[model samples]
Target: MQRNGPIALAFHSLVVVFMLAPMVVVCLVAFTPENTLAMPWNGLSLRWFKAVFHHADFMSSFGNSVRLALLSATISTVFAVPAALAITRYDFRGREALNALFLSPLIIPHLVLGVAFLRLFSLMGMGGSFGWLVATHAIVVTPYTLRLILASLTSMDRNAENAARTLGAAEWTVFRRITMPLMLPGVSGGWLLAFINSFDELTMSIFVTSPSTVTLPVRMYMYASESIDPMMAAVSTLMIALATITMIILDRLFGLDRLLVGKG
Candidate 1:
């Protein structure tokens, strides 16, 4: 097997450091004892972390973001699974158009979608409604779910399905027993990706969110605009920790290599 050359190894190491530097800095600043955002040179403190918990706006925004991400990711998955099945398993009129429509969000800019959704919601008298917000997020994240589900479906072996059908198994029974299990890894990975994206969404969320429905990213943006403090860094560190924990759990449950790269 060919191994990475010294130059290639050095380049990869630099890339990793470049990507991780900001997160490392934020985590370090989060421990600062000073009121201002800075590295904890003199001493480490947990006051900012405690402040994040005590701050009502941040807590509320965190709750909203969690609920929003959960709902949107699940909703997108529910739709994406069936849509993926139909797209892959059958021939239908306008199949290409249907596939394109579902994936349109990937190409259209979020800023444009946000504005369009805002106008549509206003006309429908649904502006600032949490349900509508969840729907919008589901729409934005659907393409992620769809693509993964499509990959799962396309890569699936058909022999088991054919054998089950040959033995007089019903289509639903075959799907439940064989197909769904095969696609589970992709479904789960897609859901996690969608959830993360929804949780971190900012650009479109800013336009659509009302004060009552503000998300964590939106709240953080507002707070940072008004003040510069270690508390912001603390909040960011916590968010990074959350994302890390989530990925760890996903890796444990599904094997990230298998779920992401179709490796056994």
Candidate 2:
């Protein structure tokens, strides 16, 4: 066991570095003084970061992505909380099937779902509608929120709920005061996951969104197709920074191990 421990630790370190290297590179390149992208020292400067803010298209798309992510994550959580609660707290016909249905989107390929949405929206004459984009993102991200909430629900102690009900506490009151507080960590984790997914979504957004509603990822894709520059790196770095901050906050508040694996 002791011999294996060092090997396992080394393997884990390598895996983490492998996963994070690209992001670190992007952040490094974002500080390049030149407009072009290159590694090694360029006498680090914030020119690209400044350019990203001044770039009208990038700014607009960034706003759109933030709006869509917030809306989609909030709506997905709202729908998922009830579904998760139902699946865990009640026994009903088709419960297993219903769970599968909510999770089906995760199994489906994003490209295939994008194509399907394009066809469906075309038939409905709602192609390129912002509402359709929001709805599709919500559907795509709901499974994540549902899974987290379900994990919390399953791990939570039921004795408190039972005692509250036994003492004549109403169902709504029990849920509001007891259940919701206990579920907050899962809810927040799910929301953050959903938000990240929605914000980073490109394939589905490309099919459903109009030029006016283009998301940051899609916009970045289009820009990259036209040119390669440190501006893209700057945008990516900003996103990475935002995600890192969010994770840090969550880790401090509820502990990610508890939220993800139900253990602290």
Off by over 4 Å in 1: 1-4, 252-264
**lDDT, residue 168, model 1:** 100
**Tens-digit lDDT track of model 2 for 1-264:** 999999999999999999989999999999888757886384878888889999999999999999999999999999999999999999999999999999999999999999999999999999988888999999999998888889888889989999999999999999999999998888898898889889989987888889899999999999999999888999999988888887787676566787667443
Q: Highest lDDT: which candidate?
A: 1
Estimate the overall C-alpha local distance difference test score of candidate 2.
0.90
Off by over 4 Å in 2: 40-42, 259-264
Q: lDDT tens string, model 1, 32-97? A: 999887889998999899999999999999999999999999999999999999999999999999
Question: Considering summed lDDT, which 10 consecutive residues are worst modelled in model 2?
Answer: 255-264
Each candidate's TM vs. the true structure? 0.93, 0.94
Clashes of 1: 0
Model 2, C-alpha of 19: deviation from truth (Å): 1.8
| Model 1 residue 251 CA deviation in Å | 3.8
